[model samples]
Target: MKKILFTGGGSAGHVTVNIALIPRFAREGWTIDYIGSTNGIEKQLISSMPHVNYHSISTGKLRRYFDLQNVKDPFRVVRGVLQAYRIIKEQKPNIVFSKGGFVSVPVVMGAWLNKVPVIIHESDLTPGLANQIASRFSTRICTTFPETVNAFNNRKSRYVGPVVREAIFHGDAARGLAFTGFSKSAKPTILVMGGSLGAQKINRMVREALPELTKHFRIIHLCGKGQLDPTSTHPDYRQYEYVNEELPDLLALCDFVLSRAGSNAIFEFLALKKPMLLIPLTKQQSRGDQLLNAASFERSGYCKVLQEEKLTPQTLVSQLREVSWDKDEYIQNMSRFQQNDALALLHQLITETAK
Candidate 1:
């Protein structure tokens, strides 16, 4: 039987694209193998998939800051490369696909050593450190944004637009309302997402402004693990550490979104036509990718940008109000966006590239 090896981890964004493509390959009777760090979130996300054979390896984060771990991580990455090489050699997969995270670098190198064709997907406007390294080893580079195509300056880069999950498009608004216990006759609902791990600053400010905010909109906050505030309670407000199957319902329920500027999440929001108030991570917090993503979205009129550096309870409330007021205009801009069939394109690329 034909087989394929996939690798990406460290964050939900890295694995979500793989998740969207996996079911398609499985339905076609292809054997699927996944490589990820032992305790990373990818393991938890992929563990429930019965058809996928999951393999764990040592992984080192590609950090920009000085830390004691930086000295030790190179050794771990080398170990991961060797382990990945052995696994790829044994599995002899026809092709390896990567979604561009720290864990994926070793996997791409292993695929190169094994003489297997590799395809890497970049979700950000500019490539991350891991993807930049993997790009040299990859047979082709798939990008979510059209501008990223020019960054490569090579024949390998292809713009496939965004690969959004099919389930996201099938959300039920009524179910969402029921799940949140929100009333249709009451205030509009706003979903606050701080990413998979949550954003502390955003969380704090949201709660701080709840007294003024709840008067205008009911709130549903996905506060990330261990970030929940017990003191903040209201008739119209609800908070979750995270949501799995229920996320679609929550997305369906919200009339507006307050979120961090992660590329994957923003694209999904854009696809859903949800007006968003984006507070991107500051340059110190990230490599400024979120800043660029938010800026791009703002330029396109799909969302309003709120810099985290300037984030305060008052600013949050004001920006959200502006987004709500300009909601129809944002929707009109989003309506003009036509995304290609990214999943199908990737499937075809893999099928054609695989030996």
Candidate 2:
């Protein structure tokens, strides 16, 4: 039987595309194995999946800032590389697929050292530090954004669009309504997501605007881990620390979205054609990739961008209203960009690269 190794972790975004591809690979009877940090969200996610062998390795965060940890991280990285090399040698997989994270660098390098072909997927317009380092070892680079292809400057790079999970397409709105106990007669429902880690600023502003927002819309907020406000008592509002199996139904019920501009999340929103108000992380919080992701969606008329500096309860309400007004336009723009075959294209690349 054919075998494939997938590696990526840190945030849920880094592993989402890999998660989307796993079922397809398994269905085709390929042996799937995942290498990720022991404590990262990836392990929590991938380890739960049946038929995929989960392997944990040492990993060091690749921070751009001058942290004291930087001094010790190189050693961790070296250890991770050695661990990954050992796993690759033992697995003898036909190919390694990377979804770009700090943990992925070692795996990519180990694959290179072991003479295993590697295919890496970058979801942002620009490559992250991990992907930049892993790029040299990869045989092919797949990108979600068209502009990202040029950023790699590699002959093997391809703009294959985003790998949206098939489960996303099968969301049951009625089931979602039942879960939320939201009535169809009430104001339109708005789903708020602050990414996997949640956004503090977005959470604060949304909470502040709840009095006004709940007047016009029932809110379903995925507030990230440990960010939930227990004091919230609005009958029209429901908050979840995080969601997995219920996310599809939640997306199905949402008439609009208030979210951070993570590429995977936004693309899922786009594929579902949900009108969105995107609040991307500022340069201080991120490397400004979210800003670029948000800007691209805004330019395409698929969503509205709200800068961090300009975020306020009043402004949040106004932007939400604006996006709701333009919902049809956004949906129309999204419809023009058909992504139904994106997952198939990526799977094909993996299979062909394996051969």
Candidate 3:
């Protein structure tokens, strides 16, 4: 039986790609195993997959600071790498596919040491450091943005758009409100989300600006797990930590969207044909290249970039009140630009290289 190992998790951006790629791998008669950081969101997500054998290693983040915490992390990496090596040895998987969060480091490093083919897929216009560092040894690197090639030193990088779930490619805007519980009659159904943790700055602005926002459009505010204040109320506002059942349907109905510029969120919004306003986190190192992503999309006319520091209730209300999207151009650009075959390509590349 064919077996492949995959790594990367912590956020939905990492987990979602695994979700998107796994079904395709299964269909092609391959068994998938997952390696992730212990006690993280990845464990919760992958544990339920019947065909996936999940393993967790003690891992930590890669930081730019020269702190005592940084000094303490090498032992974690040593332990993680050793654990990953043992998992790989037991599974003897054909290949390892990575989506470059710090969790992926040991998995790919172990896979390389074990002579397993390693492939990395990056889902941003700017590649993450984990991916870039891993790419040095990756058999191949796949990227969503063609322009991102300059960000990598790997020559084997392929310009493949993000591998979104099959559900997203088939989203229907007409029935979106039914799924999100907003008004189908509402001309613009704005979906507002700020990554999994929710952007406090954006959420605060939206909360302050809600009265004005509701005047122009019904809103779906997917406040991250703990971000909502619980005091805000609106007849036209739907709020949640997450909505899994009908996300695609809700996305389809959205006429406008406000979200963080995380790689997955950007691709998902583009797939749904929703024009966007991106509020990238400007928090310290999290400034970790999101600004570049926001700038790129803003320049392309696909999204309006809003800085977290600069976003205010008045600014958001003023913009949302008058902003009009070029639906035709958006649809055309997104359809032509989207690489819907990302999962298939990953499956093919990993399977081929594994042999």
Candidate 4:
């Protein structure tokens, strides 16, 4: 059987594309293996897949700011590379595919050391730090944004567009409404997403603006783990800690989205033609990738940008209302977007690159 090794982790954004592609490889009878950080979210996400063999490696968190862990993380990363090299030597995979996270750097390096072809996929407009390091060691780079292809400046780079999960396209609005106990009231439904871990600032602000927001729109909040408020309740509002199978239904029910500017989530919203009010993470909180992602979507007229630095309960309410008023225009711009069959293109590329 053809064999393949995959690696990515840290955040859900890093691992979601791999999750989308894994089942395809499995159905083709390929033996699959995954490498990830010992305690990262990827371990939890991939462990549920019975067909994929999971390997844990000692990976250091890649941070930009000064931290005591920074001094120790390099050694951990080196150890991870060694462990990954051994695993690759034993598995002897035909090709290695990485979705680009801190854990992926070691896996990509190990694959290069083994002379196995390595393909790295980047979802953002610009590459992340891990991907930037792995790019030098990679055989091919796959990008979601057309502009990202130029960012790489490599002949091996290919613009595959966004790889949206098939399940996302099959959501049922009826099922979603039933699941949430929400009626087809005159008010439109707004889905608030703060990513997998939840955004404390967003949760606080949204809750603070609930009295005003609920007057105009019904709310469905995916507040991440342990982010739910036990005392907060409203007839027009619903909250979920996090969702898996039920996510599609919820998406189908929502007419608008208020979310952090993660590339994967925003693109999924775009694909579904949902008007969005994006509040990207501030430069102080992140490397500013979210800001750039939000800016690009704003320029394309698919969403309205709200900088987190300026985020207040009042600002949040006003921006959401603005997005609602301009909803039709946003949908029209999104309708013009012709999505690529990225999963198929990526599958073909991985197959051809395999040894």
How accurate locally, in lDDT, is each candidate? 0.92, 0.92, 0.79, 0.93
* Model 4 clashing residue pairs (backbone): none
Q: What's the distance in Å from true for residue 261, model 4?
A: 1.0
Per residue, candidate 2 scores C-alpha lDDT tens digits across 1-355 of 9999999999999999999999999999999999999899999889989999999999999999999999999999999999999999999999999999899999999999999999999999889999999999999999998889988855989999888999999999999989988777558899999888888889999999999998888899999899999988698999999889899999999899998899999999988999999998999988999999999888888999999899999999999998888888988998997675778999998899899
Which of candidates 1 and 3 is the stronger one according to lDDT?
1
TM-score of each: 0.98, 0.98, 0.92, 0.97
What would the per-residue lDDT of candidate 1 be over residues 87-176, giving only the tens digit for each residue? Answer: 999999999999989999999999999999999999999899999999999999999999999888469999999999888988898998
Estimate the TM-score for candidate 4. Answer: 0.97
Clashing residue pairs, candidate 1?
none
> Across residues 1-355, which tens digit of lDDT does each residue of candidate 4 receive?
8999999999899998999999999999999999998888899889998799999999997888999999999999999999999999999999999998899999999988999999999999889999989999999999999989987856979999999988899999999999999988989999999988999999999999999999999999999989999887999999999888789999999999999998988999999999999999998988989999999999999999988878999999999999999989999999999999999999999998884
Higher-lDDT candidate of 1 and 4: 4
Candidate 2: which stretches are off by over 4 Å?
none
- Looking at model 3, the pairs that clash are 173-252
Q: State in Å the error of residue 107, model 1.
A: 0.8
Write down the worst ten-residue block by lDDT for model 3: 321-330
RMSD of each: 1.1, 1.1, 2.2, 1.2
Top candidate on lDDT is 4
Q: Supply the global lDDT for candidate 1.
A: 0.92
